[model samples]
Target chain A: PSASAEAEARAHQTQLTKPAGSLGRLESLAVAFAGFQGCVKPTLERIVIRVFAADHGIAAQGTSAYPQEVTAQMLANFCHGGAAVSVLAGLLDADFRAVNLGCVGKVAPHKNLIDNTIASATADFSSAPAMTAERLSAALNAGFAQAQQGDLFIGGEMGIGNTTSAAALLAALFHLAPEAITGKGTGIDEATLARKTQLIGKALKLHRDQLTNPAAILQRLGGFEIAALVGAYIGSAQQGVPVLVDGFISTAAAAIAVALQPTLAPWLLYAHLSNESGHKLALNKLNAQPILALDMRLGEGSGAALAAGVVRQALALHNTMATFADAGVSHAD
Target chain B: PSASAEAEARAHQTQLTKPAGSLGRLESLAVAFAGFQGCVKPTLERIVIRVFAADHGIAAQGTSAYPQEVTAQMLANFCHGGAAVSVLAGLLDADFRAVNLGCVGKVAPHKNLIDNTIASATADFSSAPAMTAERLSAALNAGFAQAQQGDLFIGGEMGIGNTTSAAALLAALFHLAPEAITGKGTGIDEATLARKTQLIGKALKLHRDQLTNPAAILQRLGGFEIAALVGAYIGSAQQGVPVLVDGFISTAAAAIAVALQPTLAPWLLYAHLSNESGHKLALNKLNAQPILALDMRLGEGSGAALAAGVVRQALALHNTMATFADAGVSHAD
Candidate 1:
């Protein structure tokens, strides 16, 4: 990020026709974009969204509302432009694709679906580590490759029991109890939620020693898609592209990525506060303020896609609105 | 609104590829538009933005940060495509215009500027009624005339001390003290805000008996732009067009419009929660849930224009997204 460019943009905002600071967070967002783009006026014309789909062995423990096969089904849906993110990507004219990291069910090939499978599914974390170190490395490399392009990057995840993995990851990283961070995955009832929490609690205890570091915690409790998301976030920021982080599971990835590389924090913008109960607590841990709060919890980059429109509007107003001198309007006395 | 269409849309949302209620407010927003358009799927293609510029009588009390001449200056800015709303409307491709209800300074003729002058300005409400019944009626009719076209209507106000007028009207209608509803207008200092609050308190006491109904309170304390907003809101709903109400001033107008005709509430959607302290209280009194809360306090329908993009996205998803059967995806089990 360019500090000088951010300073220049902030100074320029005061001269706009409207009252200074009246545009609120939008003014700050424009300034931040300017810094990221290293220009006074930044544009987000080319947006890229990559939805990583895999299966979590945690689903075998009955931690998800949907069957594990839904992951592969959603991948096909994404490729066919039927998923939430797919529809949004079409409307936004975004460069979008689905990466099949690994799923329990077979996914058919399509132009928009990228094959980057490491395993059919991760091992169930309740009884064992989710992935071997080599599998984790391959997944991270796959995600990192996707972050090579686009003006803005949005990383979305699809794994049936990913929320359980994310909750366990956050609980260990934040040093919180499982009950505090665990939430219903898709739409689990009270009994399932409690069971999910208990399962995560047991997994945390089983992997307490191995959870000493971010990557170790991720290997022990994170799903393949989540680790990929973490890799993508780091790569996007390294390439000087801002990443718009999605909901609960995606935020968990961001948390790990930022923890691993603190400098990467500046390049990630949270999209929205999700319907998941732990999302707020997770966001607070990172001191991140999301763009919208429509109570959305769909995990296919939809929230981030929705926020892309807002960020575009912010940049448009910044780049096009006339200054006080141009408008011949009086400034505050 | 067609209740049957709304119900149909709600059911249709459940059949889409995502989980039920996963889209949160977007789902309900699409359902609401379905009702308003009287179709299972609705579109928001033609958006209309009308900014009413007038001078407030209470500027005589030094309640605002800018001079009263700014009312006319902003009218020219709006026409020249330099103001915040002008830039937003241009980006949104909205049908945009500025209506000059009444201003202390003379405004030049422009293609996008409509002349509807009722007086040089209203009487100082601190000493007398802001506008007579006849002038109020004329202002409302002028605003009503602007609401005849477009799929959606957005009413914006541009006046130096209209927040003072809005605050006073809200206080009178809600039977609250000025201290409860008064806030800084365009970045007023502590001294100016305190003086503004006390001035409104005295004005309310002076008009205690006459502030009986919504219209009486409006005539006694409202600016011409605010009254026009009220008319535009009512007019838009009457014409079967939905109205996206702007910030504090616009919400105040919506409050009066909804109170006068309770059925008008269904056609109105709150755009954003303003940074102004009184905006939340006013919205709550009207049972409004604004779509965004970016801490924006700029009037002139910028917030509504920003929200139009989100609404359009929602409708697009509703009208085009494939159902579970189409995607061949399984439902939650």
Candidate 2:
């Protein structure tokens, strides 16, 4: 945990003008950054946001409000710098890229779109496993290779009906009811939400016996983008880079990643608590308190991008604020 | 509210890439800004932070951890750009000014220091009223005159024993116990906290008969800085400029301001939920949900400075992002 650096940062925090621990989460965030960077003063200059896009076969069950083809189209929008995440990336001046792991339709090639298609689409998990073991390994490797050296890494997802897959996976892993972990994705109506829950329940029942390990669960009930996010999280931790986990889908992937490697928890920082119904449960499971609670459900690392600004502010405050001695301000009695 | 502008902003929100109500507080902030600016696309280009500094006579009763002299010393540090809020103002590129409403010690003249001293210090409210009616009017006038042509206004306070005054004022206004509203100020120990509580209880009992009016409450129990902050909040609303209310002590002032003008609620935006105990109750009384919950107890408008960045980002996204039709992205079914 870089105890020396953390100790140095804590001492520095105390020396600042404000009372000790008054900065709250910001203080803890600075200390965490110090431990991660292995230095007394941490900087958040370079940030990289990787979005993994894929199509979920569960869309055929009328689970999502949007069509499956919207996944590929949104990738085009992201490359054209017209999406919400694209604008946020520009606002934050962070590097952004989209990886097309799988899409139901033909995705037109773009300069920033990395072609790492494991399959056109996963099989409907309600009837069968989502992907084969080989496909899962390739997706994980592709995600692992996407990690680059940066001050912070953000892994997000773009997939139609992926929330159903995430809910199925979460329900199976936690041995909870589908209704307890399912929510309307992309603003689905009440009936669609019920059907989505039923679909997740069916998927969980179909693969309950086979979902013994993380990889097996990914193969049985996870989307390609979800699996890629898990790999990216683990890979970033292995490289000693802190990753900001985005909303519901990304947090589900984080759940899987942490289950695979419990030590990765320290390397993860949750960005925001989404308004999606199941996100609260997922965040509770991870024991995470997010930086923002903007109710942002758009999952292209947008929340992470906004949270990057908060982290930058934390670093700026930690590094720049004058000490009480330097400012000649009186200390507490 | 500007109905036309609010409608335009709401319609623009739906046309954006994210789902309806997904951006949550951000969307509401944008709409609020739009209504305030009387335009569809509002901006936060100019921000002015007004910090009111004073010394409380209640410090004689050992209510604060720091000496009353620290208020003047911190004012010097603020002018030299060494304080936390000073650094944050520099970071946010906002105009910063410190108004010495009242201070116990000699404060040197500085270019950025606004000398609006109503008195040398407020009287100890545990025994008597804090200020005369004439002094209260002068303090309010000084604060009301501080408002200028800025897109956003922030009211912060710097006083050693101001929390005690705030607690006493709150207890008198709400008819609650002093223990329900008292908290540790500047990192006080348990003994000091209890002493502060008892002092507040004494002040409330002393002012119980004369606390019928808001101005009466301020005159009896509020510090000079607190009264000025309340004036600034009302003045900002009267000027049609949005005010970002800071942490605990500032919130107490806000409560008094809101009580004076219920219509001013629409013009106020809460910045953060502070670590101070009474802050939550005050926020609940105002029916306000702060933008950030950073546990920051530093009350020199620091939280408001950080929240300005969020307001800026919201404006950026509100003004720049492409609509669904512009991006050729499919809409939800």
Each model's TM-score for chain A is 0.99, 0.98
Model 2, position B84, has a per-residue lDDT of 76
Candidate 1 lDDT by residue in tens digits, A1-333: 999999999988988988899999899899999999999999999999999988988899898778889999999999998888998999889999999999989898899999999999999999999999999999888899999766899999999999999999999999998989998768999999999999999999899888999999999998889999999999999999999999999999999998899999999999999999999999999999999999899999999999999999999889888898888788897
* Candidate 2 chain B weakest ten by summed lDDT: B199-208
Question: What is the C-alpha lDDT profile of model 2 across A17-109, one tens digit per residue?
Answer: 877887788899999999999999999988888889998777888888887888988888888887778888888788889999989877788
As a whole number from 0 to 100, the lDDT of residue A45 in candidate 1 is 91
Give the per-residue lDDT digits (tens) of candidate 2, residues B23-84. Answer: 77889899989999999999998899988999988889988888888899888888888777
Model 1 clash number: 0
TM-score, A chain, model 1: 0.99
